[model samples]
Target: MEAAPAVLTFSPSSSSPAGPRPCRVLAGPAPRRARALAAPHPPRAVASSRAPLVVSSPPPPPAASGTPATTPAHAKVDRSGRFCSPRAARELALMISYAACLEGADVVRLFDRRISARREPGYVFDKACLLSYNHMSFGGGPLEVGTEEEAEKLTSQNEMDSANEAEVLSAPPKLVYNSFVLRLTRELLVAVASGWNKHVDILDKIIPQTWKDEPVARILELCILHIAMAEMTSKGTPHKVVINEAVDLAKRFCDGGAPRVINGCLRTFVKDHVDNTGTSQAAESKA
Candidate 1:
């Protein structure tokens, strides 16, 4: 993965609001923060792919009525490569602690060995996770969930390609890049340094920082913000979403609470903010 350019330093234009804010560019795996808060505005020129915030969010969920998330027994395996009864509990106990740094080299070896080891019940899932981390060595960000949405898009896209094959394929070169989103991704990695045991590695250098930059400190802030967002969300998706679905998700995940809070908050953000996210190819050709 190419290194993102150093953050552009500038005093806010008079039009911009004033306050403390996390780096708007961080966009890697969602960091777990000690708390969460509204971040200051992003640079309107950055063209971030995250849709601009629009609507007001719904009220956050009330305190829970004391229920626990249950993990199944088969999910846990001992270091000896043997399964234990009461699996869920044991797995939680043995699992890597929060922010545990299972290094890049060690991660590669562990995955290679685990994949070749055997076919356990959840072995495939475990293998996928390890392979994913390896890819992070090259590219680390949210792994897209290949759901029905993607499948339908893929099929339609494929059909269009087949029909258009007759057209001349040659075209002038154009850089396919989103500087903002890429920057967001790198900043997130720095904001949450999970590749080692609280140690900075090659990733830090790739993402250049200003003269006054602290790796561990920034990561902590990112983690706090994300965690607080989840908690305030009643453990639902914190991202802004379409209206009805946002409400429904909150209700389902928040143990049957009012759904409007999530919806309102998301709607307000999208409505109020301006954005410069990259357009899909469809939009570009039309332009």
Candidate 2:
């Protein structure tokens, strides 16, 4: 028999002679454990060497209690960007006339003095007052600011109005009037001065006995009537407009039934003077 082939028996501890050994996958968790050991640890948050970016927002403003919030009423302005509203001019004229009545001075003269008065030396006007000016006070009312943009707009408008008001009502009255306003005010003052005696006679016939008895107390009301009559007689403004303005002035400056009394008085005056004049003109045209 050929030499018996060399038989090799391998035991667990015996090393087998081979060119390449097959990989033996672990049946249990050994391979998994090895993988776990080899796997990288998840990244951890570390303190940055540089300053970290931070983001923050402003705190919400405290809400007011009780009062309902309302937006501030915008003051009416003309196209000229000045406080030259006819109403404003009327108000100024009324104020001047009232002052003249109190001072017993000429209305135009008083206005001229106020317009020409010099500022005191070393007197600094606080511009910040315009921005910080708040018509509302603590417990006064609530403000309705819908958005940041709206709030900014409102604030800007309010500051502008405050500046205008300050200029108009400053000590010695530094009014920034446009040409129309200046002319209208001067005309109103001139009309008032020229027609004072005539309107006084008319008012004696038209005004109530109570007003007649207390002319000193009714000076403002009388001034309104005088302005309306003078303006109407000039035929520059419509009688209806003049009457309406007079009624509005009375409503603003007078208390209680004064507005109604003024309204009625103006209607009577218009009926007597305006209507009669129109009727006469019509009759003359027909003739």
Candidate 3:
């Protein structure tokens, strides 16, 4: 007998496998949403089941197309063929922090003809005190607040050099503690008080932590330890060892100014420390 007019039928997949049986449909175009489905009635079966309620998911949202977001750029000093180590980055930041504090002392030196002609670097204590708010530092306010009273106190001390060693002004009064090593420089202390506020912002933007664990806080601690070591070692005359130690320490801990700073701080510190000791030893020791 001739085959009865064949009704449209769907067949199971040819490669032998166990799965849901096939469904047959008249050959025609899939409906709008049906175009996405593996088979026509699967969702209907799921909906019918008393065992659990189920629903088919809609398609995912498309991604937005555009330029990517801006991010902070860190300066990486190359170490041989490779990028700097985390230790190096930390050192660099610390050096920057140190300089930023004192660089304010050169607030006058920082500018040249363009600015100098306009006005003398203001001698106003407001400018110095304002550096307690270094644009680049970790902290915002100067560790030493720059109130009129504070400035007057420091100015008075500077004038009274002959009365007593105690009376000699040690530092301008507005100077505060270094956030990292906590000794003191009139310039540096102001810088640090400024840095204490700015540090977080700087690290967050440019210096990503070396690891999840090795954060800026750790770098700061290491810097402090190295500075402390430099201070203790500089007690001897010559201070070359003091400078060396400072450099070595900065390399291991801080991120920026290991070399030049070691030189400056050692020279100044040796002169002060030795002179205070009232020793002729400095000349011989330096030689």
Candidate 4:
């Protein structure tokens, strides 16, 4: 026997099985790398064609209870470097005179009282009346205009002027008027008082019989006449302008044919008194 081939033998360690033991898979969580590789991806969002909705904030609530809303006073319009216009003074004088006539009191004293009268506590004068006062709203014939655009422009301008005049007239005498306006108003009041006394007899002759019978109803018209005559007598404003202003006042304050009647009366006054006075003065100067 040839020396027998040496047989190779393998030995196993104490902790592990010998030779090709089946792959020992321990029952435990998978490795982090293996789990990450097996995870699924989320889907992407789709694009839209619809418009986005917009949300707006709500309006503020009204004022608290017991608190009244107040209107702001309008600012005075300064014209020709004057705070108040002569027209405004004339309007104020007319109002004061009308009030005096109603109360059967002295116009100057009434004016002083009005100027000095105190405002009530927490009293807010409603200037809305002043702003909304439209002379045309009182009633008048339609305006003659060439076109709608022209009519609109004219109407807008007239409204602006009327509102401005109303603001000036409505303001307190001590606050709104400058020295010139105050002096002018005082002089007008004095002239009205004196001229009224002097022209009391003349008014009867000029006014219609119907008006004469109802003097109470015609107080405004009479006041207009007195103011116009007083203003004319001062020789400050032109007689034509005075007459026009008087007619306008009648149109604004009086109804029906008052404007026409006022115009006729003013013309008559100019013709009878102003022209004669001028003629007599000129003759005296020449002599």
Model 3 regions lying over 4 Å from their true place: 1-238, 276-287
- lDDT tens digits by residue: candidate 1, 124-165: 222222111110011112223235454444344333432221
**What stretches of model 1 exceed 4 Å from their correct place?**
1-245, 256-258, 274-287
**In lDDT terms, how accurate is model 2?**
0.52
Alpha-carbon local distance difference test for all models: 0.25, 0.52, 0.29, 0.54
Pick the lDDT winner: 4
Q: Candidate 4 at 138: error in angstroms?
A: 5.8
Q: Which regions of candidate 2 fall more than 4 Å away from where they truly are? A: 1-74, 78-81, 122-168, 171-174, 275-287
User: RMSD to native for every prediction?
Assistant: 23.7, 43.7, 33.2, 46.0
User: Candidate 1: TM-score?
Assistant: 0.19
What is the TM-score of each predicted model, taking all chains together? 0.19, 0.55, 0.19, 0.56
Query: Which is superior by lDDT, 1 or 3?
Result: 3
Over 1-287, each residue of candidate 4 has an lDDT whose tens digit, in order, gives 76542221111111234422121000112221112111221111111212322111111244689999642222233433234557657766777776565445666767778788886687444444443333232334444444555544554554454445445355566655566767777788877765554455567677778766555556677778888987877645777889888887776556678889889887877776665432322224446
